[model samples]
Target: MSSSIISDATSKVKNMVAGEKGRKVADLDSVSQTVSPDDRITSDFGVKMGNVDEWLRVANEKKTGPMLLEDSFSRERIHRFDHERIPERVVHARGAGAFGNFRLFESIEDLTTAGVLTDTSRETPVFVRFSTVQGSRGSADTVRDVRGFAVKFYTQEGNWDIVGNNIPVFFIQDSIKFPDIIHAVKPEPHNEVPQAQSAHNNFWDFVFMHTEATHMFMWTMSDRAIPRSYRMMQGFGVNTFVLVNQKGERHFVKFHWTPELGVHSFVWDEALKLAGQDPDFHRKDLYEAIDNGAFPKWKFGIQVIPESKEHDFEFDILDATKIWPEDLVPVRYIGELELNKNVDEYFPQTEQVAFCTSHMVPGIAHSDDPLLQGRSFSYFDTQLSRLGINWQELPINKPVCPVMNFNRDGQGRHTITKGQVNYWPNRFEARPPATAQEGAYPEPPFNIQGIKARTKSDKFREHYNQAQLFFNSLSEPEKNHLAAAFSFELDHCEDPIVYERMSQRLADIDLGLAQTVAEMVGGTKPEKQTRANHGKKASKISQVEFAPAKPTIASRRIAIIIADGFDNTAYSTVKATIKAASALPFTIGPRRSEVFPAGASKKPGNGVQPDHHLEGMRSTMFDAIFVPGGAESIKTLAKSGRALHWLREAFGHLKAIGGTGEAVELFKLAFALPDLRVSATDEAIESYGVVTLSKVSPESLRESITIAKEGVGFLEKFLYQISQHKNFDRELAGLNSQVAY
Candidate 1:
């Protein structure tokens, strides 16, 4: 909330680059060119000034004893800085965005009259912005954070943005403590050291004490927190909304977006390294995926609960931090979204597209989830201060639909009314807007009669049940990731009290998880605590169950590492097969380019374009890797310890591996693996995604093709598992029985 936090505007990237390249914005030539805090201009009272000329600046060395208190310059500068920041959003501040389009699969007029959902024949242009809560805009992207999934569908009816997050629930049920939760989660005011992270004393102190945050914390610690790619994460509208049919029937609904590619996350170690290697990993990945023509897509669906049965379930539908289990309320697939393009500008489009919870059309309405209520008011109000009073008139925020109103404009107005009579009076016939029935936006009236009084809903008090459910839902690997995440974050906190309290919070969620975290962080568990509400039942809210309806190798990338002395016979065959399977096959070697044999000499330029140089690339950068066989090529690969380690790392991550001819022996040597010999039979090929023949005959090329197809096949079979994250159960079981133990 203080100006100090936001004022530390000098970015790591900005400081590391730019000056070396002569000061073009967004350059990374050298670190010294970074903007230094001391070199920046400051106000007379010592505050770092954002604008030098705007303030009353001293013209000479002589201090003119405070001149006329009416000096316009001083007053204007201070006045502007006085309101420099609107309230940093109540939640979800740091974010990234993209431009795209949403295509309808089938008309849903039978369910609702909303044009975007019902207009199956049209393609609606769209803008999507993803964000992280708690951190300021300058924070890193890979922290154990909940992502905001706010999509603005610029439809003919109007812009409909299902403002949501990757998580289905929030930290609390009621809106009253929204500010309290955010404040506690934000960097400590006395000294804001931990930026973009939530393992501090204040955050854990809040979670352990309140207990309502248990469910959310579990998610924050799991693999979901460290997504491998934004393309592989699912999105959920955290609050319930209403869909009205043409018959005036209202159906309570929640929006769901299941990634077509599947859910995936990086190991914690890789994620942490990425924070330093590339804090913009997510934003860049999203942009690159689109740029590469591998457009990211998510299947759009809605879970509709009939209003007549609003009280059918024991839990109140209006609770913000609770979810309606998929088994109970199955999601009906309605459409799909494909992000085919990236934005050309960041400031005007991606940065300024405001998503308001109250931006609803005639057929869609709001639910009274208290947090939803607070957001509807907060988003609009904050935009006014952040962008001028007429923020909607800004290009990015303005509605694409036609606009006509009797209301006059304010600061930054771009429109001019022709009529002299600005006030709507009878004398001026048809002078202004009237009657809500004439396609003039109208809100359905729901009668209310009550003596106004502040009250808390009882349903909100039963918080820990869902939290318990979320913890119990994680698989062993997922649980390990969660526990490891807890230890990693808490270990960073200076205060032992922070770790001690947070350790107990984990224990309360799952004893095993708590015990593991305690061991890792060297912290003692607190005295046993009761559930936030013991009698509450566990619910279904986990990623383990979210899988694609039909699994395919579609856009998954398979990197084939090749080099000189590679067998052209085996190489030619694998390339053809990978292309046929529809998965991209990128050849990588020690050099940027490799050639086929120039008259049987292991050499350059026979006929292949190397996509990457192995030393400069890492296995973590690709989905899977393959080695094609040649005696000399395998020998070259074996010598590069880095290339060998790439295979071992990929195997440890359970990624699919492929090989043929002598390359199979190279893979064995790379991992120090024992011999795994087999003839080029269909069964052997089917099992390991590897194929080999005694020697290269024309038939061997056919066999190599089979090997590549097998790798593609293996990817297809395990795509669901890859998306669900890793196999933690297999990992834990292996660890327990390990002689390494």
Candidate 2:
């Protein structure tokens, strides 16, 4: 070939590559079905129907008669509608999912040979499901419960699933008692009063009785249970697994996913109110983030302990309730997982996807962790009943690689195979199993010699040391929140035995915690500590310790409250600034339709549109609030009790607040916060996370905005405060309690 011919060919290939890169990969597009504009409605078997609105019936003179049994079209339609819903998962039923790609920026080939983890060139397709474990399908999203963080990676070799949770540990160490814990935490059998809460008599009773659950119970009581959003929480594979290298070396491993936005959680009051104000708060947060191109991402890391050193730890490595403390076994960052695409349809993709712990590729293998052993069997068994044996055939659960097996038809089977021989060792040597050298999973060579008895390792019996370590690692605010959480939960337990025993159990973790909760819940105060705390603190154990490497307001929702006669220039500048920073800003006014600004004509069409009205949405829905300058707007807002309450409540919640011109006075009038600094004349001031400016200038605002901690202007200070998420100084300073919302 000539040089010109090769150059033309190369140009065409380059164009093709660019097109493919721009094209969104709908992996489930092949299975997607839709109604078309050119086609008429049809029955199940593809017969077009003329009238789908009415039923075919035997008609009499001037009156309708009995429906005809021969109307198969109506019958089929009704039948399909009747079976539209499958049974929701026994747990993690309320969920939202998205599709994304997993990329390995740094390979771990020295530790594991799994192509998805060891190959830097592959962009593995992934579907991640975020869920609340204790809720039913219709339950609220902000309930205080463990969030399920299950991810399925479709690699070239096979599908690898990490069925994990936001919390690093579980309530029970063994899976055999899974049903008992679930039943206790669930609504009581007789009344079924509380829908999706763990603060009840039976739950506390179980906690006190099952002393092994101490460590995990601490996590559940913390703010981690009420995450601000699914995008801001961490994920952990609770059970330990084995990683086998190409050289045949083995290591015990646990998986971790650190969010790019950092770990953050809602205050208890915010969480409780959001449950009613917006039941789908987290779900909407996720969908809108992806829709707006602010994709959620997490860094994938693993903590590995060499096989020879597994038995060197004080606690059993296989214990599900314990954590391999970051100080002892640091997590090695490896790759990244990002959710870049929203699900096309909820039912076919999010709801039908399934994950099993037994599903492994070549480099990963399950450990002898008792919880994992039972889960390996339990997950696949549940899918058999929920999705049938052919659940693997579902588009969302199917692998990117080829699958060949003797497993054949069951209910809902979609595969059509050819050939007479169906079993292994066929005459033509068809579908032979891959050898060890061919990237097949080879079980690590290890011997197990033990009696077949129901028992745990000796170290499993010693559970309080790590529990105490966790309590010692918390910050003062976190500890107080945990104590308040325990007090509230135990107070709900009217049964004296439940509250009393649990209060005493707290002494095993921390003496101060036991006394605090005991006094609040009417339990006998422990005179002495049950177990001495080791005072061993671990890094990355507290939520406050996890901060984004750089300050960012990306994807955060800010509410700009405005009314008639608001400052148009200030409002427009603030809105534009928020958008440029990649944050969401909503115009909220007295009415959702339109609100005219000062000096504007009183024409109906000459006004700014608001996304929501003050009466319809509360301040709890937003991460921050801003009020632009306008004399009439401030006066009108001062008269509205709800508007004043909004500011007061936001202050009490430790949220960032900003005001300009006369709006700064309105903020002070609402809260009666004389100590809060406000701008005087033409300057600006920031006090207790509240930013105020007496004058407004679009050009000055641009110059003032900076990313540094000490911002040069009001806009800069306000945005930086919002990026910090929450100002715990107010709550920790004991000032929030002084204000009545």
- Return the number of clashes found in candidate 2: 0
> Which candidate leads the pack in lDDT?
2
Q: Candidate 1 — what's its lDDT?
A: 0.67
- Which candidate number has the best TM-score? 2
Badly placed stretches (over 4 Å) of model 2 are 1-26, 34-39
Ten consecutive residues with minimal summed lDDT in candidate 2?
A: 16-25
* Cα-based lDDT at residue 475, candidate 2: 86
Q: In candidate 1, how many Å is residue 435 off?
A: 4.0
State every prediction's TM-score relative to the real structure: 0.79, 0.95
Kindly report which residue stretches of model 1 are placed more than 4 angstroms away from their true locations once superposed: 1-94, 105-111, 134-138, 406-411, 434-437, 449-451, 525-541, 579-582, 593-609, 673-741
Clashes of each: 8, 0
TM-score of 1: 0.79
